[model samples]
Target: MSSPPPLPERVSAVATLDDPVRRSLYELVSQSPVPLGRDAAASTLGLSRSTTAFHLDRLAEVGLLAVEFRRLSGKTGPGAGRPAKLYSRADGEICISVPARQYDLAGELMAAAISESGQSGEPVLDTLARVAAHAGRAIGAASADLSSALTANGFEPRAEDDGGIVLGNCPFHRLAETHTAVVCSLNYQLLCGIADGAGDAAHTIVADPDAGECCVRAVPVPQIPQ
Candidate 1:
C-alpha cells in the first residue's frame, strides 16, 4: 500500500501512538480519571521504567499527553523526595481536515445557537447573532489582519470604492447558492466572525448580493443605519 501523505499537527500528535508500547501507555493514561505516574504505567504495561519514561516524554512533546508533577507520598519538603511525573490526556481540540472545510464548525455553531434559543426562549436569529459574534471574537483574537485572514479562508476580499471591502469569492459558494436563506445567514455570521476576529469592529457585513459575486459585503459601520 502507498504511504499516506503527511498528517497535520493535531493528527501527527495522535499518530505518535502507533508504537505498541506508546499506544498501550496512552490508553492506560487516558482511561484513568487521575493522571498516571511513570512507575504505575511501567508496572501496568510490564515495561522497564526507562522505556516507559522515554515514550511518555515523547507523547508529551507531541502534545498528546499533558504532564504534571506531584508527590504520590503526599509529603512535602526535602524528605518527600522529588515529585513524580504524571501523565494525562491533553486538553483542547484536535481536528484535521484535508481540504480545510469548516462544515463541522458551522454545524457546531448552528447547533449551539439553536439549543441556546430553545432553552432561553429567545429568537433563533438572536441566538445565532450572539453565537456568530462570539465566533467572530475568537477569530479576531487569533489575528489582527482581517484581509489576510479572509484571504486565507478563501473569501477573496477586494477593496471597495467607498473605503469598504467586497468579497470576490464565497468560501461557501455552493451552499449559499442552494440554501440561500439558511446558508446566507450562516455566511453573514462567518463574515461577522472574520471581522470580529480581525478586531475590525468598524466594519460589518451587509447582504448586498450582486451577479456572480459573494452575497455579503463589508461596509463601514457608520453606513449601516441603527
Candidate 2:
C-alpha cells in the first residue's frame, strides 16, 4: 500500500512543539535577533550537541523553524570549517484547533469591526454585528453540514425530536460566561452567518440559552410577513 498523505501544515507544525526540547529551542530561536546555531542552543539549554541537532532538524522538517547553513565565524573558505547550521522562527503562522472552534476567526471579525468603527466614526457595536453576521454567513455557506460542522467546531450539536438542534458544548464557554451580552450576541450572529453561509437559509438560529449549554439553537427558518 502507499504511504499516507502528510498531515496539514498547521497540524504538523503544532505537533512539533509538543516535544519539550523542541519547544524550548523554538522559543529561544524565536526570541533571538540572530538565528541560533545548534552549538549555542545546546550549550545554553544544557543539552548534548547531538540531541539539539536532532530536535532542531525535527522542527525544521515541520517548517516551524527556518534553517540556513552559514559560517558564524568571520572567515570564509575550506579552512573555515563546515558552515554552521542556524535555526530561526519560520515566516509561517501555525494555529490548530482540534475540535475546530475558531477563536481566531471570531477575533478577526471583532478586530475588523473595532478598526473600521474607529476610522469611520460608526458605533462599535453596530459595526461589530454587521461584520460578525457577514463572517458567519460566509462560514456557514462553506461548511459541510450543520451537524458535522458543529461537532467539528466542538459545538456538540444534538438532534432534537422537534427537528431542532441542541448544542451540548459551548465552544466559547469561558468568554460567554464573563462577557455574556457581547459574546452571546456574537455567537448568535455567527450561527446565523453559518446558516446563511451553508446556503441553508431555511434554518434559523435562535438564542435559547440553557444552564450549561450553548446559548443558541438551530431551528427551521420562520416565515416572514408578505
Candidate 3:
C-alpha cells in the first residue's frame, strides 16, 4: 500500500499527443513512477480501454513511446495475461539538441544582417560583434517553431544583454563532433546572410564561415591573397 517513487523531471522530454485523451495519457505517464500498463494509463487518463490502446499505439508510432513485456506476478489466467504490455519512453533513441530550421536559416539571416551593416571598421572582433548583434535579433525574436527547431537540432542559443547569442545547448557538437561541416556551413551561411541584410558593403559573410568554436568568428582581415 505504498506509493511509487517520483518520476524524473521532464528533461529534454518530447510530448507527441494530438488528442486530448492521448495527451492526458502522456502527461500522466510522464509523471508516473512505475511504468504504466494500458489499463493504468487508461484509468488515470479517464479513457476507455480501446481508446487508451489507440493512443498508446499512436505514441509508439511516432517514436516517442515503447512497449515492454513484464511477467505478471499474481495473475492466475493463462500465459500470465500475455506478459503485460507497458508503455514508456523509447530507449536509445537520440533527440537532436538543436533543430533543423535554425540549421537552414539562422546562419543565413545572421550573415545578411552583418553584411548589411556599413562602417564595420577594421579588427575582426568589431565586425563579429556587429554580426552577432544582427544575428541576435533574429535569434531572440524567432517564433516557437524556429526556437524548437533551434533547440531540438543542436544550437540552443541564449541572448546576452551585451548583444550576443550564447550557445545555450549544442546538440550538433554533441552528436556530430567529428564532422560539423553541414552545421558549420549552415551557420556560416546564416551569419553571412545577416551581414548581407545589415549592408556590410566591403566585407562578405563567407569571410568567417563555420570555424571551430561557438559564435561565428569574423572573416579574417581581407587581404590580397598572393
Candidate 4:
C-alpha cells in the first residue's frame, strides 16, 4: 500500500479547507453520490463558475479532491464538445493529530493479526508481532532509507552523537500508554523488521522506553573481529 503523505504536507492540505468557500465546495463534492462538474457545483453553492473552478482546482492540487473529465450530456463524439472537468473527494485518507498518532496503522496491524490468528490457530499477540513486522518490512523496502522510512511512519528519528537513533515521537503513543507491553513489543519488532528490510544491519533495535518518546531505540550493532 502507498504511504500517507508526511505530516506537514497533510496538515497543509487540510489547512486549505480553513477557507469557508473551499470547505463548502469540498463538502458538496464529497457528499454527492456522483462527481460534480464546475457548473453543477457553482449552481449548488451559489458561486460563480470561475470561482468554483478555482477552489475545486486548488483542492485537487493539494490532493484533497480528485478531478476527472467526462461528457455530462451523455452524447457521442460527433458534437460532444470538450469533456467537463468533474470533482470528487480523493480516495486517500487525511488524518491529522497534534502529536501525530497512527491509530489507523495500529488498527490495521491488530486486524491483520486477528485474521491471521484465526486462520492459523496461533496466539493473537504472536500474530500481531509477525504482521506488524511484515508491515514494517514493506514500509522499509519502499522507503529510500531508514530515517526516511521512520519519518514517513511518524517515528521522528533523530541521530545521536554516539551513532544511535532516537525516536522523538511515538506513532502509537496513546495505545502504548494503555497497553505498554503489547504496544512496545509491537514497536520493537516493527523497527527490527524495518532494519532488516532497509538492509541496515549496522543498527539494532532495543526497547528503552522513556518519557515523551518512542519505546524503541536503534543502537549501532557491535562488530566482531574478522
Superposed by TM-score, candidate 3 places the C-alpha of residue 68 at a distance from the truth, in angstroms, of 0.4
Tens digits of lDDT, candidate 2, 112-194: 99999999999998888888888766656556776655665567788877777888887777777788898888888877877
Off by over 4 Å in 4: none
Q: Distance (Å) between predicted and true CA of 198, model 2?
A: 1.6
In model 3, state the lDDT of residue 67: 78
TM-score of each: 0.68, 0.71, 0.38, 0.93
| Per-residue lDDT of model 1, residues 1-226, tens digit only | 0111234665787678789899998889999999999989999989999999999999998888899999999999889899999999988445555444455566677899999999999998788777866775566556557787666555678887676888777756666667778767877876787787677876767888782368888887676556
Local distance difference test scores for all models: 0.76, 0.78, 0.51, 0.89
Q: Which window of 10 residues has the lowest lDDT sum in candidate 4?
A: 203-212
Candidate 1 colliding pairs: 136-193, 139-197, 140-197
Superior by TM-score: candidate 2 or candidate 3:
2
In model 1, the Cα lDDT at residue 128 comes to 79
- RMSD values, in order shown: 7.1, 6.3, 16.4, 1.7
**Candidate 2 Cα misplacement greater than 4 A, ranges:** 1-20, 43-48, 61-64, 68-85, 90-105, 221-226
Ten-residue stretch with the least lDDT total in model 2: 1-10
Per-residue lDDT for 64 in model 2?
Answer: 83
Report how far off residue 176 is in candidate 1 (Å): 7.9
Candidate that would win on lDDT: 4
Superposition error at 59 for model 4 (Å):
0.9
What is candidate 4's lDDT per residue for 1-226, written digit by digit as tens?
3467777898999999999999999999999999999999999989999999999999999999998999988997788888999999999889998777889988888999999999999999999999988988888898888888888888889998788899999999899899999989988888888887787877888888772398889998877989
